[model samples]
Target: MSFDKFVKNLSEDQKKELLMVLKESTDTDNKVAPKLVPKIEDGSFTTSIQKKQTEGETFGVPVTEMPRFNKFEDDGSDHKDKQNATPDVELTERRRPPFKKITQTCTRCDNTVETHPQFYREFYICDRCLKK
Candidate 1:
């Protein structure tokens, strides 16, 4: 018989007793199994590790923080002074230029299309021409 049918046939007291037994078994199993610790390191994949001789405490290489840059006060150019300058501000995003969409003309057909400028120049063809 299917498990659902068997469960349906069981009395209320029997179901309660079965649940209690199952819960106790799960609790025991959890207690028996050792909890795994994730190994977190720079440029290393995160992996679950168990207690073993090979999984002993490892010395990590100390990483130096990026040097903070301060604007030259005595520069000849007069720039607006920042009221609240944070040293821990990220430098990457501010340095990057925003992407602008590029427009291209289809060589096969006299059709104009807008496309992002790529590193390698590619010939633009209209979708209708490409389908043919």
Candidate 2:
């Protein structure tokens, strides 16, 4: 895309035509420096860190300095520092949250345990599938 490189391959008339074409293609936004495209160079083609320009949460290992994350980010809002964490005694006394409870009346074998809501709300997946 450089003028020096492109003009080397052109005749006088063809150069004029090429220059006109280049001028026509030029726009005001060239200040953004067209994305540095890596061809077959830059070593491996499968690197995940050669990230695309983005405006959102770009996940995975960052190409630059990695921001520190505490334990909260790993388990989300579940885990916390020992000082702020729920005591084991309290957890044992509290009723099990619904998300963990197994229900009955499963479309599969009802006589066993109650329905596991994770499997029942969608379709009946028996204990066999649960093992899977």
Q: What does candidate 1's lDDT look like per residue over 29-74, in tens digits? A: 9889887776567687666676554432333433344343455588
Best by TM-score: 1
Candidates in order have lDDT scores of 0.73, 0.63
Winning model by lDDT: 1
lDDT of 2 by residue, 1-132 (tens): 897887787789998887787776675446557676657756765855566666544576674766653444454655566778865673346686657667554456554456545655645556665675
Candidate 1 Cα errors over 4 Å, as ranges: 1-92, 119-122
Candidate 2 colliding pairs: 103-114, 103-115, 104-114, 104-115
TM-score of 1: 0.27
Off by over 4 Å in 2: 1-6, 28-132
Model 1 lowest lDDT segment of ten: 55-64
